[model samples]
Target: MRRRRSSGTRREGRGAPASRRQGRRRGGTDRALCGAGTRGDTPWPVDYRRSATAFLLAAALAGGAARGEGVRDPVADAVSTVSPERLAAHVARLAGFGTRHALSAGSGEGRGIDAAEAWVAARFAEIPGVEVERRRVRAFRLSGGARRVAAGWPVSSPAARFLFGLAGMGFGYREPAMSNVIARLPGREPERLILLSAHLDSRPGKRFDWRTDAPGANDDGSGVAGLLEAARALAPLPRRASVWFVAFNGEELGLLGSRQLAREIERAGLRVEAMLNLDTIGGTTTARDLPADPALPPPGTLLRVFSEGRPQHRWLDPSPRRRLAAGPSEADSPSRQLARYVRAAARRYVPDLQVELIARADRIRRGGDHFPFLRRGVAAVRFTEQREDYAHEHQDPHVENGRRYGDLPEFVDPEYMAKVTRIAVATAALLARAPRAPEEVRIDTSHLGETTTVRWRPSADPEIASYRLLARRTASPDWEIERDAGTAGEVTVALPRDDWWFAVQAVAKDGTPSLPSLAWPSDR
Candidate 1:
């Protein structure tokens, strides 16, 4: 989704203040490297619990962080292969289609929505070990007389044409058939999925004008291009979890395609570990009318990641406002955790681009394809360009008052697109290779003590070498400290439970860390 101006206050730069110093720990024993029961009993009861069978299995795997000072990282190598030229070419090709409007006509000739869908499917099919599918979306009616245009109503008069165009801008028109293009790269654990998505549809200033040329190059062509490039880079690598490269349709029409996919995921009982949606990721310039924020980093040097501040379904709570007022978990939602993960990954891999965290579901009053997955309780986040040129988005290609308008390919920065692509590649690759997050993570809040007890069920993945207990101040936006809890399923930290938020992540023997699972308060 593209917005004319940013509404919320932006939190600039990467993660918590203390996260800059890597491999550092405070107030915790490094029992993760040592065998269980090696440490003596402490003042507070500490249960260094571990399953004997799981520990024995982990010991047989390769040890240490995946990428060390001298070691070559396959993940990093794949990330380095992201090409600016290839990404730009994709944007150009998609733009050449004239219009990719969700309800646009024509197919088999590489034009309109069907052609875009076919092109995306064919590209994924070319990559070895990748399976492609076009999942059909049910036909739905468009409101505000948009069905008139869909029904081919005669508009002989200029007044009638104007009325029809106005109707197009209302909501959306009837789409008899639309499909989301999905390309799956199966891994050792096919059920555990990581998704990368972008919308494949575009619209002109006259939202209902299907015949007009709305290239949509930077708005989302760049995103689809990035999805393809990430797939190409990660396809040849060995992954622990599966990755799905999806090009969603009807995003401009209220996220219809994503909503369908989310329903399918729930119906099939598929677990989406993480979902990254790229939208308008190629623009490097601010909108013509809106001045750039002086406090923000230069356009091409930064990117924004938007995630929900609280659970998407929090409205389901009977007393949501009261519950939120009493809780300190506003910044600790699953989607927020995923956003932090992306920022951390960018810091480690995409040094050239600074990822700014927008602690909101999306731009004010605007939505994207990620919202549907987020509503389904998936850890989803969006990646968009630091600044969007509104004149280009939803505008037709024309010169008006000496200004060039429309989302044209020439306005997209290839270098910037490459950097954004790298962030996705690095994050997805690392996550795909890491062990699944520890399950049933909980913090014991029964006793009134200064120290906190964190526990979780050991990950069944044989690659898990240890677990890291992460904690941050209640007021902090990101994790501030990490303690190596080893293979032990539980740890006692010398910190006040009421003053901090805690999470646990399983670390692979090769040093890859899985997504952190927040510790829920429990009386047990």
Candidate 2:
């Protein structure tokens, strides 16, 4: 299930931010380690309630009552519609394909990669208003150690066709057409895309085997099921930004599908606010009933979100690291902030589910479709079951010691899958409905003082009703203080200037918040 290499090799950048050990607060107000190397209580400040109230009052007085004070439950309503039975059914159907190996026959009736692709497309088309399309590209075979393209890649090069033809005849290398299934639900801001994705191909014994039962029920069938369910639920909801539900092929063959898709996205120059990859999110039961990690929540209760640390102000010149030698909070990358948002959504919508934020890019030595987009500088994260059942993933069906083995539907907990699906629905709906984050934010450090002043350019989005000032201690894992700025472009707060770091967020009238735009050191 892991094939892609980290973008660290492709892009020349500063060293990674220093690693910080995450700690859990057992008593008192749970403290969060903020991106700025500070620590503090939750983001609820003393004046937050009053400030929020004041903001609401101002909106009403300004004839914004229609947008404010209106209770909306589109996300909640969509979450409620997630069906466990449907998830299980989808998993079963995908497994029924026998195998989805990347190199499997493209033309077949009910038994190969083409059949699986068609099935997903047909399912999405059943939903009204979904514009479905297939993004097909030549799959590339990577060399050992994932250092270079061994064959069938760089097909756009002028000499690629001639070279590939020779390689096919002389070295028996074949370039297969890998397709990604994309379904879009148009919104008011159609250009800004929020992608929810999963991989479609499966491996039986090894990656190249095409004639074995590779029932990837949990490996990724569970993920694809979640995507389909989210699309069905969010299709009827109100959206401010478009949502693209995607299932990529050939992930087991080194993220080929996602690699091509990410390149296409950059080529088209679309603004992808975020990409969420759902992979191996099926069972809650651990393999051999082993003890769960002491740091993780109990099984059936935790979903792990993996995000890599990157520059907070992605558009910064000379890069974020050059501006701040310490670099952005390794824990507060844009994707990490989005992970925090998802965690918050679970608390509000799926109280029974707990989302564990894994501060690293991905599991050790393992990779997923999210890698391609992450490398491209897009905020991307991967969602997986907290406690993986090793025997149930990437294993061929067999009976060992009288116990069944393989990633089969029987091992999947549909109810758990549904809960995971609800989290995705909540996140997708919330992010799409909220205004985009402020385009620019900065902190004034011209003269060191006991106070800090923050300023930001508000989003042109009419959905933005106000702005919230966020401050976090350097040691806190999350933002600890939030105050409503009431649509102000600048706010001065008295806190020991060097002790706290800050950010600003655009807030919708409904209280939905966009990902925070970190305040960078300003030249002004």
Candidate 3:
């Protein structure tokens, strides 16, 4: 079903005091991980009364959880292999190619970069029934003189066309021969699509030194591996949305391959249901000289979920004032639906997973392949490990402190990437195969002058028990459900809307929630 929620939120940054750190204590007076004191023999965060409320909510969310006294994790066979490992191998192989500069292929007949492209194309063909498509794109090989226009992208938007027209001025024979090789999977429902992609190109140089072998295994090999692993797992499960796995080249050269794909989609009037651009999923933060975020005194504390778009901050800002403006939103796009689904699914599968949504475009200065799709109003998000060891990215392959440098396989961890992939696979499969997007989502504004009434239809899944309604303002990124002591989907939030984009979703008997309703009607 089509799921589009509204986005509204407060944007002013606050001088949040340093968060107090505390260890979780059982039945004690110590504070929980949230760092607040608890009465002796009571739960860390709440006393007996509040604890009972939490337990009831848990039982409501999952009958199994209630009965078993724990969350149920789906049984997944060991995903023994992760994408970053494979990426390291591929990068190592490319390192053997000497140098894959843009224009260097023109000099050597050994088919330097073409050989690399063919190798990637061959891997995709290995996937059963997956077709490999090679697109020969022509752009000016910008060099010293003879600055004349050759063949350019056909029927591109003015902004895109201008970008492309000017982009070539920075290329030439010094660059390696470049093109894009793409592969796709037809999902159960074609209306929605999930894309998994990685850049296949690396920087140019003579010797395959630290300056040459991006070995991009960790940088993007992890991404490709994620895409492939997701496909491998989901092929057996019927999905309502189509999934596309791509190995894009020219990412180092300013996201060239992604640009072409975005323009092509726009030209064809394509519907990109959602994009999970898997870039640099490997390599945890262990670089000896790692520059730290001064604001963050201690590093490597949280697993980050870099989310953007209109509804990016929906959970944090759910109020009537921001109803039309925010909450669990990708804002009137398929991506919003995907985000809501993912957020809900994550809560379902990983109860204690710590995910922080960065309100604006992925981090301060970094960007991912999702950018192109987003520019065209397609829903998109980037999945990267929370902390990055910047030393490994885009650097020429080299060694320091007797430690092998470059995006090597040893640096990438499979288990971490597997967790990331599993959530994605589950979310994609559910969205693609669910009966349809939920029906008739309306925030009950009838009592907006006082109480909050947010509701939606439940999924027909037979196992569904009740529905959960989470509220937040447009200004915050946290979904603070006032837990008065009840089930996950107790219904009808009672929080007063001060400056929020109030939204809600129906929960099925199985404990799954429908995508959030658009913002509630404001009192104006």
Using all chains and alpha carbons, the TM-scores for the candidates as numbered come to 0.81, 0.82, 0.64
lDDT of 2 by residue, 402-444 (tens): 7777888888899999999998998888788778887557665
Cα deviation in Å at residue 78, candidate 1?
A: 0.8
Instruction: List where candidate 2 sits over 4 angstroms from the true fold.
Output: 1-72, 140-158, 161-177, 284-288, 291-296, 310-327
| Model with the higher lDDT, candidate 2 or 3 | 2
For model 1 the local lDDT of residue 240 reads 86
Summarize candidate 3's per-residue lDDT along 169-222 as a digit string, tens digits: 653322235677777777655655667777665552222221244455566666
How do these models rank on lDDT, best leading? 1, 2, 3
TM-score for predicted model 2 compared with the true structure: 0.82
lDDT value for model 1:
0.74
For residues 4-39, write the lDDT of model 1, one tens digit per residue.
Answer: 111111111222222311222332444442222323
Worst 10 residues of 1 by lDDT: 4-13
Stretches of candidate 3 above 4 Å error?
1-91, 94-112, 129-131, 143-177, 204-213, 288-302, 309-354, 398-405, 408-410, 435-448, 455-468, 473-476, 480-493, 499-501, 506-517, 520-524
- Span of ten consecutive residues with least summed lDDT in model 3: 20-29
Q: How far is each candidate from the true structure, as Cα RMSD in Å?
A: 9.7, 8.5, 11.0
